[model samples]
Target: MKKEKQYINIFIIFLFILVSLLMIIPLVRNGRINAYSDWTFHSARVQQIYLNLQRGNLLTFIATDVSQHTGVGTFLFYPYLFLYPWAIFKLVVSPVTAFYLWYASITLLTLIISYYSMMRFSKENYVQSLIFAFVYMLVPYRLYLGQVVLGEFIAATFLPLVFLGLYEILWGDLKKWYLLSIGMSLLVYSHILSVYLSCQVIALIFAGYLILSKISIKRIKVLLYSAILTIFLSLPVVVLFITDFIGKGIATTFTGIAIEPEFNSVIVDSFRNWNGFNIGLILMVTFIIGGVIVRKNKQLKYIYVLGVLLTIAATSVVPWYMFSNTILGKVQLTNRYFSFGDLFLAVIASYGLSRLFDKKLDIVRKSILMFLISIGSVFIFYASSTWVLQETHTYNKELYLLLQPKKKNGVPKIPDRVQLDNNNYNYQFEYRSLTGSSDYYPIKAYDNQSKVDSILNQETYINGKRRKLIGRYNTNTIKYRISLKSKSRVDLPVIKYNHTEVYVNNNLIKNSRISDRGTIDLTLDKGMNNINIKYQPNFSFYTCVIISAIIWLLLFIYIVKVW
Candidate 1:
């Protein structure tokens, strides 16, 4: 029995490797790289982290080149967990190769984690576990997401682990609470929007478990502990996001006019937009078949029901507009809920296959089942390979050239006379600039373009003054000398955050404030005023980071010892 099990494991490992290779056929064929939508942007973010580390900055929050060199807190608002591995890979390899390596690692990890998670749920049913993990990895919607949205792909990859952990906590051992904590933390770290959607699903699962099974105080305690631990582990990133959101008033107001459209159109559009390959029908049918097959298993039945409901909710059936106008708008998309649905459907399909391959089955039936499985496997490979090839070809033809690095002789010298034009400068070529948008920077050119143009023609001027560009300027800090002809207010073109501080002639300016356009407004005195601007995080940010690091270290030690 042991030898047979070892052989099965070997075969499964081989199968996993074969599938992984099939998935990467497009990437291997290209020899170049896949610069699909958002790939360049994400790659650039990883590059920023690498550059920051090279500059001796450990905790990098500000993107120096964003907002046309004014800098923006990109990492401050975005999750950094997924980017860390890619950034580390970039240290030893080329950026493009590092990206591919990151994707490959993630894909492999997804398969391994899913397979293990399924094994935990299926107990001795190793074949069923293998099938579940394989199906989950190759789910068409997930593959489609991998090509476009990486964060969602990562979050989706871990969904099975999260569910398995949750299941263990609710229905299995109380000692496995740590699994839930780790899973929840990983999900939160991978993507903030995913975290929000995942919380809703978890809540539904918890409620369903309560309805279906008897709960004990011990189980409740485990659940609470897991929740608390998850929050504690993710506190640093969560605090940073909340602090930035509150500082920016992002949730209070809607920038655009809210238009109410017909309900049917909204639902149809939502489904159409998210369902890349119309895989919803296959998922629905498989889920029903699996639910029927696993009707006796209470746990599987609950999962099937959860999947059906989530799948429906992901469509236009729910009043998304209401949620969008309210707190749920922060998530930006209701369709993301489909990922959870897909996960459940995959589990159900695995159960159905397990039932079909039961020992009691006749030889003829077993042969037919094996043949059907073979055909399905071939179809999945063909479909996935074709999809990847098409997507890669389309991306290479269109976006690959745009992201290609251009050779430069040397750093371009900054012009002595800097123009504060209201017209948006295209920063596509300005790789050094942290942000591509100019909306945050405050300038005098909005109403006085002619005046700004006149000043730009002069030997030394930004706002009708002889301002000498002095000192070293980088993403985090800017230093310049303003030889103001007279005592005048000099507005520095920089996006203002709560932590942005300005100092003139080595003295910190008390009343330095952010303008309506999100730039720093500095009141200057006559004579050569040495101006210095810096982005400094608050005490809370430091405290959170230190605490988070300590907690993570302790968790790592505990996990190592326990495992």
Candidate 2:
């Protein structure tokens, strides 16, 4: 028994090393992230977050940089929690190196979390756990999200924890409610759309669970507890999402527009393609075979069914277009369903393969099976990269400036001012409002986006006179010193939201008016008046942040105490 345990420990070490080292394939193959459909957008986001953090803006909401310095309110509508980690990395490293390190960190996290969740599901089957980690991480869809640097898939790292929390609540140990909260909260922090997608899938699972099993009061309470705790923990982001969206403070690219993409053939998606992603061949085959063979476990059966149903939803089998204008179409992309599909199917496949890939199996057979899986995973990664990384328009362009060749001296220092182009959406899956689309631009600002140069370059309006006066801008706050004779009305270039506040010499000016350009309008006192224009979210925002922080801290303590 001692000898066996030693071998297992060694193998686990090997697994960790293998996974960590393998993350270098992309970095080694391509030194920098290619500006694919969303690369410019995400890279810009990272840069903005880095700047904000550098300037000590802990709660960054309004960006004061993009779109010719008109800035964007993306932080209002999007959850920026996961990006914080990447942004922190940017503070210490070059963007190129920072991105690569962030990628590896996310992958390692996914592996560890997915493995633990699968171990719970498979009743501590190490082999099954390993397979679950690989299958979840290696799927074409998830990796494709990463290749483009889209954030929804980053939230996927916590999905296994979400699944485990559900499992523990409904079927296993009931004391681990914090796991669900942690998972859902992280999802909200990472991506709003993932939270939306997750909620729908969770509802379906509950519906199915309620149908098959007897309704129990205990079960409902556990589930509700997990949910309420998650809500409180994620309230900071949730409130922002609600406030911005409900207030109609801005126009988003897909705000009122509903689009249904034409489906790629299932066969093409299952194999390999330059087309967008779906569940690939290995997953498809595994799901079918595993679902049929692993019949004894009812839980596994439900997993199988959910996977199949979601796969259909992602493809043409479901009449997605019919509901184009409905709330369902609000999801925008049908393939997003496949993230959940991949999750459930990975579980089923891991289970089915577990018995065959057991340690008791012949050494040669086990070796061969592992070899095949290893090769197939590599193939999936390559196939996913075929389009985005390989053919990106800015593939040859570095994140900021090209690296100085080896032996060259006086490499460029970081720029004092970084300019981000609109790179606006043209409806071909290309966009860079720092999102997949130009989300949450004030309506007036978006209309004037074309004239951003003129807007910024034009003289500032002061007492009906043109003055070339601009404020000193950090990421969130812009300050200006304006000297005047007598009282005068001034129009600063700063854009104003309902939540935006104006203060003169540290005195709050309530009932501030907006200029014709949709920016803040100010009445100034004579002599030098200090003007501060910045976004200050309402009381509810701070309340949510405080509550969310408390909940998260409690959850963290519980984690240390319990697990």
Candidate 3:
């Protein structure tokens, strides 16, 4: 029996890999590389992280190649942990291949983790676990999310493990509370929006469980410990995120367009148009059946109820305005609720399958039921494939052509000033000016061309003293040979950030300030001055990261020894 079980587990893993590969068929088919809507955006981010890592900057908070001329703080504001795997892969492979590998690897991981989590809850019902994993992976909403929203796709990969941890903490072994911390930390790092949505769902599940099961002191203590650990482990990220928010406001704003008061055409369109809410007939039936069969199981019952609530919230009838217009609007869209809904429904469907198998049924009846279920599975697969292919074709035909690499015919000359063009998407302006030109200029310089040109061209003066730009250049350091006739303040085309540092000759400049146009303003000494401008992480950021790393290591050790 042990040997047979081992073989079955091997086969299940093989199936997962096969299914993951099949989902990428559209990308691999016809020997072509396809681009999704957000592929360029994500690819640019990955390239930035990889290049920064290669440059010996281990902790990347400031991205110097976005926002046209003036760089933006990417990692400082956005959740970039999801892109780390791609950056690591890029160390060994091409950027494009690394992206494909990242996507495929996440898909496979999601399936494997989903299966194990389901098995834990279902008492090792292998067949049902496999089915749930398959359904969850191929859910239309999840597929659509992968094509357009990489962050959400990455966050969904950890949802199962989160529920697994929550289940153990709330009802099972109290010592397993660490699982919740691990899962929540990963989710928080993956996407802020997903974290917000996940917290709401977890809260609903906890509430439902409280209503169903007798409340015990141990459970409450375990729950509080798990929450505290999760928050503690996530402190660095949370602090960074809040700091960015306070400095730059939320990354997005609510426009009141996504709210709908009635469940009518718009709601129908979201389901019918493959907009990340389509549950499909098969999973819906299984979910309902599972809820009925497992009505007595407290944990499963809460999950089922959570699924129903999420499903309703995903629709247009819900008062999304309250959430969307408030601080929660940073999440951007209410449709993201469907991702969590699909997760719970998939688990419920698996429970239903396990229950169906546990009952004593005649062979003929079992055979008939199996046949119908198999047919339903095929239908879902066909529908999902069709949608993926259509999306791929549309993306390839419309956007892929624009993204083809343009060859530099000759050594391109750099303009006197970095041209802040309208083509800011994918950092196209930066890429062209930096990589396709011979001269050195800030790739993402300040957008005000006139101001930048004034700063870069001609001489700068301070306190009625003039300084001449004898020689200006850049390598790892922005170098300048300034013939300062008299001691004067001169401005350099480097964006000012918390991490920016300037040095005169070899000594650190103690009083460098940002200019009105966001460049570094430095006071230069008389005679030829060698100025170097660079970005270095502050001690506080490093301390936060180091502390988080230590906690992560300790958590890993605890999980390995105890779990």
Candidate with best TM-score: 2
Off by over 4 Å in 1: 1-18, 31-37, 247-284, 358-382, 385-388, 394-475, 478-483, 527-532
lDDT of each: 0.62, 0.68, 0.62
**Which 10 successive residues of model 1 have the least lDDT summed?**
416-425
Better of 1 and 2 by TM-score: 2
How do the residues 249-322 of candidate 2 rate in per-residue lDDT, one tens digit apiece? 56665632233334456656666633346677667786558667668987778888888888777766677767
Worst 10 residues of 2 by lDDT: 421-430
Model 3: lDDT of residue 135: 76
lDDT of 3 at 173: 64
Best by lDDT: 2
Those runs of model 2 whose alpha carbons end farther than 4 Å from true positions after fitting are 1-14, 25-29, 239-245, 252-264, 273-275, 287-290, 359-438, 443-470, 481-493, 505-507, 515-518, 523-530, 538-544
**lDDT (10s digit) by residue, model 1, range 511-548:** 68654434566767778998777788788888887887
**Tens-digit lDDT track for model 3 on 1-563?**
67756766776677667666655555544323344444444555676677777776556654444322223455555578778888898888654456667778898998899889888777777767877887787777777667657878889999988888888888766777787888888898887668778888788777777787788888888878888888778877876655444553222322343633233543443345343456655455644565676678866676787777776677667767677667656555666777887888888877666565745555445445444444454456556556445544433333333332433331122222221111222333233332111111222333444554443333344543444443332222345666667777776545555555678888888757866655678777789877766556556656777788898888889778874
Return the clash pairs for model 2, or none.
none
Give candidate 3 regions above 4 Å deviation.
Answer: 30-37, 53-58, 65-69, 91-94, 210-212, 235-277, 284-299, 354-382, 385-387, 390-398, 401-495, 504-507, 515-531
